[model samples]
Target: MRFDQQFLEDIRNRVSLSDVVGRRVTWDRRKSQPGKGDFWACCPFHSEKSPSFHVDERRNRYKCFGCGESGDHFKFLMETEGLSFPEAVEELASSAGISLPAPDPQAAFKAAKRNSLTDICEMAVRYFQQVLQSPAGRSAQEYVQRRGLSAETLSEFQFGFAPPGRDNLKTALLAKDVTEAELVEVGLLIKPEDGRPSYDRFRNRLMIPIHDERGRAVAFGGRTMDPDGQPKYLNSPETPIFHKGTMLFNVHRARKPAFDAGQAIVVEGYMDAIALSQVGIKGTVASLGTAFTEDQILRLWKFSDEPVICFDGDVAGISAAHRAVDRILPALTSGKSFQFAFLPDGQDPDDVINAGGVSAMYAEIERALPLSEVVWQRETSQARIDTPERKAALEKAVEDLVGTIKDERIQKRYRMDLRLKLSNLFYEESRRNRGPAQKGGGGGGWRNNKQGGDEDRASTARMEAPDTPAYGVERSFCTMCLMFPELFERHFERISQLTYSNELHSMFMTALVRIATDLAEGTVTQIYNKLDERFYKILQEAIVSSRPDEDSSKASTLQRWDTLTNRLQILKEDPPEDFVEHLFLNYADMLELRMLEMELEHETRAMEENLTEESWSRFQALKQDLTRRREDCLRDEQELAERGTKMKLNKAAMRG
Candidate 1:
């Protein structure tokens, strides 16, 4: 009966949310925009004349402003018809013409055991609540008062206490016909190896029930009253019904509020969660343990768009936050990521509230940093970047980390943002250390000169030779442009990339690009007049390798280049549009191939320098892309030749 998210989304995407909800309520014409996939209707859960129920087809979710009811297609059907989760999914799938996956017997058996264990845990919850209200719970009552917890919070969270004994919970549950093995299975009792008898896991401690998303009690967290307790905090051991890594405390209660506020807060423990919730910050949950797993991170996304991990600003908190970045990177997509908030040193959620009340805690939340900033800080905060080798190492480390991101668009963005920061950092350091002689020099190689500089050269060098092997490709791209200067108008983006193997070709292209763009209706003589003496002087030497047998005399060098362009025009008589596209694709693909090969080679060297899973995966991805693009390049040429042959045959028949 368990369905993955993809299957649910598949059904949701196929059916219109409004069509489903329309069956229950009439649409409000004054506020609805059917074309935009936004609709407003009256509350289906409660009676209201004014429409507060909204269905947004773009998000495929409906929200009720009156009753505070919100959910998706399946949730709507389940709530309206009083159907179970599986029945609702089956209804949606049948309507959407989608088939459900076959049921798994193993999964069904596991679900049955989990449901049974949950029942026992519920029984334990009742026992704890009873003892909490009895005379034996007087100590627990005083402790809640000392912590500034109100009567409402104590009753709302079902706060309880475990008596100081080996068989307090066991004896109570056994009298209810709960077997000893069932108690042990749900982590309520601890079985010893010495054949001594199983006892209660939590003793003389404050108890908080851990609930699943559906608000089913599955486990418990206990905090000790003794100041010198060996472990100040303890959580339930893993059971069929409870998984520490997969569940977050207070998530069930926080989900709706988090959705309304468009944010979620994460603390370390359930105590922090209670403190924040008591202070009216209800859109908060706590990671069950020290480790934040992939499943928990995704669950946070379900409640809020950008969930913030609020931790203390001390060393331990910052270190823990840094470790979380790696776990989040591989799963990052376009807009999905975590923000981090650090409380002041020597402060927890309780301390923050005590010192400044709720507004002060809100201020801390306002200062939360984005996940990208955390990545930058984690990389540059501790490393030494005073030397080129160190700088290269830093860049390589960041590249490897960014490469772990599965989304190509997000990975490219991280590269751009971090590289800009790196440039500024290095530039400031250079300015501070630069002597009087180096002041006139500008920083223009990679960043200011179109984002290709020392970093590209260092990170993507060929393994075979010290010099780049992409020179021939760069030379051809330049020659084609010098012949067909009109190419500047059409393929501006690729030309501007200037990802060249040689500096002189890149410089020449930059100069030509400026003349083509900056000048208004540039004529041949106007272009010649605009060229500086030094630039005109090296135009021949820069292009000498393109034509070695030609004379290098300064007299007719410019004339010789013009002559070659005319000759190419006469010899190439294909259709203009096809010819131009072919030329652009050929040049662009060659440049890309050369650059990618060098990057692949350099990645091998980088792996040898520091072998890691991220680097190895990146290298393999580059190789795959290179193979795919190489085939695409050949396909382009073949398609072009077929078009050319068809053109020739059609013209011949027309003449006949």
Candidate 2:
């Protein structure tokens, strides 16, 4: 079912875009603008030099100039991570605590088919768990014992056993009134040409239930006890409920601990994960015996920035690590890092912890090699450093590594380090270029004409670009305003007088007008009541510098009032769009101020004489007219806002 726009807007309101994306990308608060509370960061969707990615917290929208990507939270997830419509909806719903409505009649058939299949798989998991305790499960139990796994660990991992007979699961499922077609749909039973339905998967094997992050059993991986078994391992076929590429073994159980500890340990096999957990290393998970995928790495990063990869100290393990590094390098950022921990020869985490203690295993993990060094060593070993070919290869590798680093400061530092290393290597090559025969009498220094020429060209090319300040002047001004609102108040009149076409300037003027109207209404609370939540938050930050105390002096109050009045004057000089409504609101605000002043004057006049009937009648008529005008202005403002909403809808439709 498609979500309603209002419902989606509600979800956006609940979920902070900055908080959601900031976990993946490092974001720096941009200078605060008057009406806009926005942040900037390098776009994760594309590579760029300057941060052109803008996040509008108030509007709940994000736009990237480099990639031309713009969207709300759900669309961002779909585009950024390549998730399907329903998958994105499911994820956002789970995050936002929203429950999607059931599918319509058209979708009911497909939904029912999926539900039936999922029920079968869940039933299968339960059947296997129960069978593991039966007489038929003795061999499976013995296999677990041989592997040094305890009953508690087996239960925690949800290890199960399928009986040897082909019809065993079928018979059990049939006894529960489950149909043949339903079992076939779940990949448990296969349909033969003879029109008979029979089990074709997992016979006489130990079943390991594969769970999603929600702890739901979606599929299984079965291992055979018989050495002569046709297949060593059998995995569940793809169904609506499971996708192997997206699933990480034991993640359902490991996520909480990993998040709590601020790191996750990724292993190669399910056994390695189980072994580590049994020995008190609970934050471990394994890919489903496949290559490390970008999607899997993103999922891992969602829980923590640092994930330690533990591989067996073997040729296959080393090869896997190299592949992982190549796949994951482009996804890394400055704040995010990875490490590798290689076990001893012919050993795994299970063996290490069993032979030694958990502390000993922890020490090995603590000494894990950083991801950068691992990448460098692997690249360097593939070629000879003394040759020109090797030097070129090194330069390319360094460039690749530096390019992948998202943070500008970190990338620059890495580039400098790489240049130094290359320079040293080149110096050694230059020394070797000169023959040893001329060294004793008069040393012939090696001249690298090609290298010197290339360096000169590179330096000349670099001089073409002008240096720009990291933070622009406008941004600096906005940040200063946010940090010290009182200072902003002091210079408010000057700020209001300035005019500009930029978004920052427009937003600031909007905020200043709103603040002026609020101050004229007497109390800050009255001003907030008239404004939307988004504008209110901006005003709160713009005005409240330090807390007001009961002992605040009259002079301090007058100074604050004067500062605010000046800021309002400057903002009014060059008003933003909707200046007409702002003027109307300001007029009504003046009426309220006048009424207060007149009421005080009338109180003082009461001592001179009882007010005459004519004077009282005139006073009441004036008050009524003022009230009527104020209400008329309020009605006009609401009508204008409604028109603006309609205009936005029309614009969206036209674009679509």
lDDT of 2 by residue, 111-177 (tens): 7776677677789888999999999899999999998898899988889999888788889988998
Worst 10 residues of 2 by lDDT: 439-448
**Candidate that would win on lDDT:** 1
CA-lDDT, candidates in order: 0.72, 0.63
TM-scores for all candidates: the values are 0.58, 0.53
Per-residue lDDT of 202-233 in model 1, one digit per residue for the tens?
Answer: 99888889998767899998888777875777
Pick the TM-score winner.
1
**In model 1, which residue pairs have backbone atoms overlapping below 3 Å?**
none
